[model samples]
Target: MNSIKQTCKNVKTLVDSFLNSTTPIFCTPTDEPKDTEAWYSTWEDNYIGDFLNNSVVKAGLKKIADFYCAKQLDVLLRHSSELKASSYPQLYRIYKECCKRLGFVKMPKLYITYQIFGINALSLEVKGHKLILLSRMATIRLNEKELRFILGHELGHHQQGNLVCHTVNGLLDTFNTSSEIFGPMISDTIEVPMKRWCRQSEFNADRAGYICCGDIDAVTNLFLKLGMESVCSAYNEYKELEDAHPHLQTRFTELKKIHKTIKVNR
Candidate 1:
């Protein structure tokens, strides 16, 4: 109990120092090569490189090319509340600040929808229109830095060229509904590999989150909110084969390792 209290105290001290300091202590959008080349998870880069080249994935992409239609209108017009500087001043500031710090050439639209519980956030690029969607619970529960982490993580998908692959997964889910026709075919060619790649992609995004939030303690705290600190087992790995996101513990461990390396280098 004392250890936990001490840790929290330490984290609070670090966060206060970070916010109060004038100098930039972490990488900013100006840090050249404004893309994942700077901070991509090496394993994720290699895996995605191979995943993109696979003849099956290439063929699947061709088949699903037409499904990349923009849905920003549907989200904006029919579903969620859009965040704009004129309206949601504070939240919008955080969104824009994250975009600038993350090196996004064009700011993506941000939107939020009601959700009673649980944090939810996602980003997508459809026909060149990019947007980030978040559950209202996220804005209500997370602090500004944690929110930056979420936005940065989502934007990282675009930075790392994972959007098309993500779109493929979304389309696959839609196709799975009519599994009698598309199941065996997609399951054989694209499903598992795509899911595996998507899980790995989270590591890349976590790195982006770390860079954007500029606070490891805040990142881990966000993970705690997501219930990702539990132990992971072999069974968890097997079950995660077709999961889009990795286990919380696995993600926490991976990010911790990354944060250690980043600290040493800095």
Candidate 2:
């Protein structure tokens, strides 16, 4: 665990350095409205309202991604130190390729780890700067293409710039991580919406990932290896949403829809 913590600290340092040097597109404080009501009124019933509503969701997604990346980095440093030095050089390289292919000039940093608990695969941090985290164990379990897609998914969160989501997530962590006794009702109220937003944000990220990966098979196979198929089978057999991720069929369908739109525009 000491090694894991050390690795996490190093990754955090790297992320801080990169963020310090990089200027964010939307980090400026504008005279724009702060509340959802004002935003909706200003947008005049456009999709911007939905975008504002999604702020909290986006932030939460970032926190989750950051935590997952930290965990993955720890795991990678512990189990695959040599592979980290050898085979994993391509990890960030492929991610950069994917980003460039998708027209993202500033590729988000990819932090790797062995494992992460809870329902996180990857996440992005958008507080002042953008950082991404990936599970090393998850990456090792996946093929090159899938890994790239996963990283792209996290980058999507960074692009989304959802600080409200991150704040809620941070609050939840504070409640759980602390010794304070919070009631189930309050916890449930905060958690349910957060989970729903997380699922929705993932769909958006899937679109981003598909665009970056540029290969449907690579993205689909990554989901499959992440146990999507098993979850689908279980849901069919038992009638339930069994996994944290969106249903496999739904995710695939959405990706295809986005891919078609992107191709038409291109």
Candidate 3:
């Protein structure tokens, strides 16, 4: 109990220090972001890099990815169907076009699952193979522009080298670390930074969606629906800090800012 408390206190201190700095302390900062989209500078610079330099954290993250990636691939093979350019030519064409427009040279293996029930998508790298899982709900509900946004967002994670998604991909496998140190490691180092990075990373991804699709309304609507923002505003608080992603309103507002900038620049 004391250890957890102390660890959280220490993390808070580091967070404060990072937030106060002009530059983040990450080892490999995105020196040149491939996507010319905007960045959430304050959040990214503060919360997105400590784990990159930590050996213990890296080991734990790798363990999670290795353990779960294969299983996820296996499960997808069983439950999800791959959308190939040969089999689904039109969809494949769209995928290719999205990659071309987004400046993503390499395409990730893409899959779509039925009855997904949620408007969601995921990007992960398994055994050096990058993959994107686009849910059926997204296909049904989101327009082509919105689809471009979703695709761009997922691909953006790849561009950002989103290491944490590798860790998150394993979450469904009942995350139990093989090493005993992992528990302490989580409490001691990984938890808070991971939370912040995951959230901050979403900003960069959203920028990708906005830039690639070039439609703020579509992007904003996707976020608004995903968070059930209307429902939340009526019943729940405007924002929930515990969420891995930012509030829908916050995301939409940020997109609006981007829209304003684009308009002014034009």
Candidate 4:
């Protein structure tokens, strides 16, 4: 535990140094041409590079990614319903707008599944293939701008190599079936930092969402509606390390700071 905390601290120090030296802003004018070349240098989360370079994290991710991808593709083809522009024009338009703003030349395939309860969204990558999945409940519950924020957040995951985080998560979901095999393969060294990186990836995605929608109020209202405030207040550092996402409080607070930065820069 002490070593994990120390590692986190070291990572924080490096992140702080990187942020100090770079402009951590993504709220650019959409009218300008997509600056794909400058995307990583100008707007990427500093933590992504650090975590991706970690040998243990990379090995663990590589081990599970192909298997997870095959599993997900099977589920997508067999179980999930995909959304196309011909049938879902409004939703497709919003997705296209996000892709354009993010400068994605190759659009990801989009899929949706109906759920009796809960609102959720996720993105996946298999090798170079990218995909985004949205719950029908999410589409029904969120307004257009809020929906854009959600979609953009998924896109954010793809943009920053955060896709591997999803592979880890998917592997966990199937732990009952695969645990005997995977449990031996993934060690604490790999799992701990990978989880830490998972949490950090949310910040990057939130920024992408903000960039896509350009509406801080929509972002705030959506999070509040998701009940972030009630759940986040009680969360602690230890709990945060175990969880895949940052406390809603942490995410919203960071978004608010980014909002302020956007205002000042504009």
Candidate 5:
């Protein structure tokens, strides 16, 4: 029993380390339009473009559009003192608009650190504080539009503080550390559903990002770039999970569909 307990502890440590090392996969946009143009051209020449132009993509995009409309610029900036008062007023306005549309009321405390390994953004709902950490490496490289979208994505998690569900999910993850008798059963009963829900949440957040950025094209481009970067990264193994967030092409397609459908209905 003591040995079993020790083994469980070791497994927990290993799992935690694995999770911590995994960074939020995202791509930093190039500062120059020419650079972006070149990359875009290359991407379009590749398979991603083919995936984006598919019927399934169109359907997904339409689903997002039907669910929510784009947010207004003024309403978005109401809580953002730093952004509203900045020289880049337009950028801040865009950010605020996305937040408003997504009904993101609370601002998570932002932390930056070079020491953090793997992830780009983390949203933690602790006892009293909702904390968000953005990777300095990721943030320093993003264009204004990309930055706002990423921030809005984190805000999406903040708004989704359905505590009971989160707590249950956490407990299940912990319990599945060992116990061969219960491990596979618990994973199937809990982890699968949790991951599916998380993926759905990502779609919602992507919609929020498009609304905040005020440009589906920008959002799609950013997604494509990020996907490429993810594929290039050492942590690219996460992408191998069929159950992870929908493929990048699917997401981009969904966004496009949302934009088109909303425009038609409006």
Candidate 6:
């Protein structure tokens, strides 16, 4: 019994260390864009990059990304449409407007998958495939400005080095089914730190979106809508108390402050 306990403890430590190591952010092959200098502070990227690039996390992510690719593939396949200037001219127009300022060295392939329902866009980078999934509901639900926020936000992840965090998250979820006994423990140890990182990383992405759209109201409205969706009976003010994002109020306040600083500096 003691040996088993020791073994468990050792395994947990190893997993924790693996998850905490930093992975390098994804970048283009040559003449990489340094746009993050404008949108995100180096400290912000360093803080989270330190944890996301961990060898274990990166390895696990490489292994599990295929699961998500397979699971959501049918829906993705249906769309079969990649948005570009030639193909989806109108939508591509909006994407380009946001892309240039956001400083993406290369654009990720955009997949517009129509499911009967679901409102979301996703950024996934794994094994050299970078993709953005724009769902049907997102197209229907968001207006031109809101869509700009969404596009910049996704690009923000790429630009600001936040996608590895998402990749690490995918690994945890993918393994939850098979490793029930150890999964929860591994999940808890990483959650708090990851939660903290994710929330901060979100702030980075939000700021990037603001820079792209140059509209505080559009960005604030985007988060406000999500916050209202997540609201229960009470509002939590503690920054660390929330899931991978700051509360709506916190975000609204912080973003306002950031905008003010930017205006002053400019």
lDDT of 1 by residue, 1-266 (tens): 46434533453454345434433224246654433243555554333356465544444453344244544446443567888888789988888877776667677787787632379787766545676788889998999889988987887776776666776677777887677985765665556666878887888888877777888888878988988746777888789776888887777788888675652221
Candidate 2, 1-266: lDDT as tens digits: 46434533453464455444544325466785321111101113323224335433343344445544556445544642332325567775777666565556555555554455422354544333455656556665767667667766766666655533544455555565464454353244444444456556667777667666668877777766655653356446343232224676677776776676654111
Could you give candidate 3's per-residue lDDT for residues 149-171 as a string of tens digits? Answer: 88878877877766445465236
Query: Model 4 misses residue 244 by how many Å?
Result: 2.2
lDDT of 4 at 219: 86
Q: In angstroms, what RMSD does candidate 6 have relative to the true structure?
A: 6.1
| Clash pairs detected, candidate 4 | none
lDDT per residue (tens digit) for residues 36-82 in model 6: 34445334433234545655545545544554565565566576577
- Flag regions of model 4 displaced more than 4 Å: 1-51, 54-63, 115-117, 169-188, 234-237, 263-266
TM-scores, each model vs. reference: 0.71, 0.55, 0.69, 0.70, 0.53, 0.71
What lDDT does the true structure give each of the candidates? 0.69, 0.53, 0.63, 0.68, 0.49, 0.64
List where candidate 3 sits over 4 angstroms from the true fold: 1-43, 53-60, 165-189, 224-227, 230-239, 262-266
Candidate 3: which pairs clash?
none
RMSD of each: 16.0, 12.0, 8.2, 9.7, 16.8, 6.1
Q: CA lDDT of 254 in candidate 5?
A: 54
Candidate number of the best TM-score = 1
Which stretches of candidate 2 lie above 4 Å from their native place? 1-89, 103-105, 115-121, 163-167, 173-191, 230-249, 264-266
Model 1 CA deviation exceeding 4 Å by range: 1-41, 44-77, 115-117, 173-185, 263-266
lDDT of the structure predicted as candidate 3: 0.63
Candidate 2 minimal-lDDT segment of 10 residues: 34-43
Model 4 lDDT per residue over 1-266, tens place: 57545654564565455444544323446664432521421334444456665655544454457554777577665666777888888999999988878778777888887632467887777655687878888888999989988898888888776577567665654562467765533434346455666776788788878878788889888988777764443448567877678887788887787565542111
- lDDT of candidate 4 at residue 59, scale 0 to 100: 46
Task: Name the better of 4 and 5 by lDDT.
Answer: 4
Ranking by TM-score: 1, 6, 4, 3, 2, 5
